[model samples]
Target: MAYYIGTNGLAAFSVINYLHAFMFLAFLGIGSTIQPMISYYYGARKPEMIKSTIRISELTVLSLGALFILIGFFGADFLVSIFGVASDTIADMAATGIHLFFLGYVFMGINFIYMTYYQSIGYIKPSVGITVFRGFILLILMLLILPYFFGINGIWLSLPVAESIVAVVLMVYARKGVMEQGTFERRF
Candidate 1:
């Protein structure tokens, strides 16, 4: 990204990296809060309880995602300003990136919820697939492709775009599970 977009872009991305670390921590905390309860329900074979737990957790995360987007959108200037970049150009770049990059927060919550749900239910494949896809594959693909079209903005969009794609796939898979067997099973 730095290579494609230059030094200023790298500096802006550094701000994003810092911001994303915080987001990751919050997501991890949410996952930690939900995982144990879901795991217990699954172990006890309480499918209804598991369903309820997953549902509530998903909602909680989605709400958090919304909050994150607001922080990134409305607070973009302040958020970037906090970094004390010497150049207005860098600061503006970071602010713009924040607005674009934070769009992923909407989908990221559900992706984590699904990953947690799968892990809790002993379905390792989907969990791993979700992690690998979001963390590596989709990220790389989006970085490689989005830039070809959207230029610098595409670089900013890489994370959210990858996350949104994974979330869609997860939602479709979960919906299929609910429709087919009346509940999500330990499968893809």
Candidate 2:
């Protein structure tokens, strides 16, 4: 979107995209470390252990999300500088994007935990469905919608909006098990 709006040059855009991909992988690595600890423990009927693991995941995600938002808000230029973004307007747009992008992470923590819970119970289809909606569908929507409204900023804002919706949907789906018994075996 930045490239489309002419705020970022091709080379700078490519570098920034690479950095984003690297950060995504880093986040996945960190998440992978904790997900199995909760999933396997919960699957084995260790309910108390699962609760403790959830607390740990919450704290870790909160800390990381806060730090990321702070850096993205305050140091956006420093990051774009690394990609050699020379235009002031482009730098400002990148900074705006950084700050707005963090909102998605806050909602993502909730969605991720819920998705992991579903996955832990062997409800792989629902879990994958949620991911498809949250990932590709959201991306496609942003690609199609944001450019018309907010231009580059719209692209940045689309993420949190999509994530917020997905989280709400997941939460609503979760409530279907409220009248049932047990964790994974609860029927809707």
Candidate 3:
């Protein structure tokens, strides 16, 4: 799709993708920190502690998400420039892609948090389901369907759309579990 957009598009996408990789790793770090702590608390039947851990982790992840949005929105040109994007068109496209793509970060962190929470509680099925849908299934669907109508903007939007959908699904599932358990507790 970037190639279809032109060399500038490809170049801009490359820069945005590289930065995205780093941001993804940072999100992974959040998962790594929360997973074990949540697991240990859950194992001990310490529901309060588990809740506290989740609260803290969610706050941290949300902060990071906000930072990503800020950087992507305000610093896109600078970020692209770091990748040696000299062409005005490439810089502009890259900057736009960064701004649009980082919108996903708003909800992406919550998806990660929920996925890690499910995994920590040993609810492997939902964790795997969320992972598969967000990382592959929904993404592929959006990539295939959206671009046909909206063009490159659609392609850029695919991640946010996928993440937002998965987040909503997970939130609904969590709410159902909470309703059954009566205290935001894990069902499994």
Model 2, span 98-164: residue lDDT tens: 7787667666765666567667656777777778888889867876788687766677777777877
lDDT string for model 1 (1-188, tens) is 67776898899999988998898888888887888998897678777777677778778888989999999989999998888888998899899999999989888888888888778778888889999999899999999999999999998899999999999988888745633454545557
With candidate 2 superimposed using the best TM-score fit, by how many Å does residue 106's alpha carbon deviate from the native? 1.5
- Supply the global lDDT for candidate 3: 0.82
lDDT tens per residue, model 3, 19-131: 99999988888998899997898788777777677678768878999999999999988898888876888888888888889999877888888889889888888788889
Q: Candidate 2: where are CA atoms >4 Å away?
A: 2-4, 7-16, 171-182, 186-188
lDDT of residue 54 for candidate 2: 57
Q: On a 0 to 100 scale, what is the lDDT of residue 23 in model 3?
A: 90
Comparing 2 and 3 by TM-score, which wins?
3
What ranking emerges by TM-score with the best candidate at the front?
A: 1, 3, 2
Ranking by lDDT: 1, 3, 2
Deviation of model 3 at 177, angstroms: 2.8
Off by over 4 Å in 3: 175-188
Deviation (Å) of 95 in candidate 3: 0.4
